[model samples]
Target: MDEKENSTEVFFDILIKNEVVMETAPLDEQKEYILPDDDYDFHAYRILLLIRKCGIINEPFFSHFTIYGRGKFSFFDFLIRYPFYLKRVIEIEKKPKLLDNLKLRSFETERALSPMIKYIRGPWDHRYDGIFNYMVSKGLIKVEFTNFNKSKKAMCLTLTELGIQISEQIIKEEPIWVDRMDIINAIFPKNATNERIDDYIRKHFPSLMLGIEGE
Candidate 1:
């Protein structure tokens, strides 16, 4: 393994061993057992910390950029909800046949393009694994598996306290991206169903709904 992978593995070993003991230990002992500063890949560490604070939950879809935006316009939300999709659109633009193959037409606005592109792309991107794995290894987030039956399983991601704290600090220091709130909010409104989200996107961002039936 490379340095970062090796370091992260060592960190996970320490974290898993200490998790139970730390829960029952004295406050000072708990603090002492926390991941050491020197052991972290600082860039990845900071990214996860920032993401947590921004209220963008990392849902671990097939793509690295598939995080959900919740509660407001934060940098993490912008990264996942906008720039990531924009990059995908750019890729599509470079190859018009891609849109044609998917039975989609390019839209002039992001509102129209975002959802359709995401649907067509199907969230398979794995570029964010480095940061994700680092966060997992450091115990800032966890991976859980649910076995539904003899042949099915589902994986879920949830944050830990340390992850929340770091993300909060990132928010406190960075300026909010106010303009993108409507789009972000539409993508993940409070308790909305997939059907509702689809309806809302189609109604408000018509460009995204183009070439799809039942609009």
Candidate 2:
């Protein structure tokens, strides 16, 4: 298949996998179009990949990664992964009898997942991002609004039944997902723009990007 067909296929694959795309009556020619760009697809790829990678499918219905933008998340990560704070939280959550000890205030809801983030990247020295906060802006997941704590207080959270179900589905299915960014970014390089992205499509998928010309 050609580039146009291939990319459309990929989009449908995502829609089908998530059960978002369903057959509907055909639309007019003008409506049957999508802007051409590697990063356009990359954005979707990153969001889905990050959600799956973070094992959010297994966490509370209010997964922070799903809710907030990269900036907000960076702030939360700063607090949770700070060497001193992360160490303390992980020790509490990682205990063999964590569920049993949930009664104590120390076992507050954030305890369920925040510590795992700490264990992954300790010492509180990681890069910052705003994408995660954007996720929040998109209303993709449940998240606590305030990011910073002058006193560095941890927030409380809980797992709704839906979260618990999703968690189980992830564990049981272990679905295979290819990070489309691997392909998307590879085509566009690390730094590319809408114009550049459009040019590529015009070059490779002529009919798709309105034909390559002033590249």
Model 1 has how many clashing residue pairs? 6
Candidate number of the best TM-score: 1
lDDT agreement with native, every candidate: 0.41, 0.34
Top model number, lDDT = 1
Model 1 ranges off by over 4 Å:
1-124, 145-155, 177-183, 193-215
| Positional deviation of residue 173's Cα in model 2 after best superposition, in angstroms | 13
Query: TM-score for each prediction?
Result: 0.36, 0.22
In the range 1-215, model 1's lDDT, one tens digit per residue, is: 89999999999899888874543767666654434223346445444543343233323332121123221112223234344343344353364433322322234324421221323212212224554577788877654463322443434334667766665565555433222222333335422333444444455433444354442
lDDT of 2 by residue, 80-178 (tens): 222233333334335433223223234432343222222121212221124334444544334444332232222222223443445445444433222
List where candidate 2 sits over 4 angstroms from the true fold.
Answer: 1-31, 36-45, 55-139, 147-215
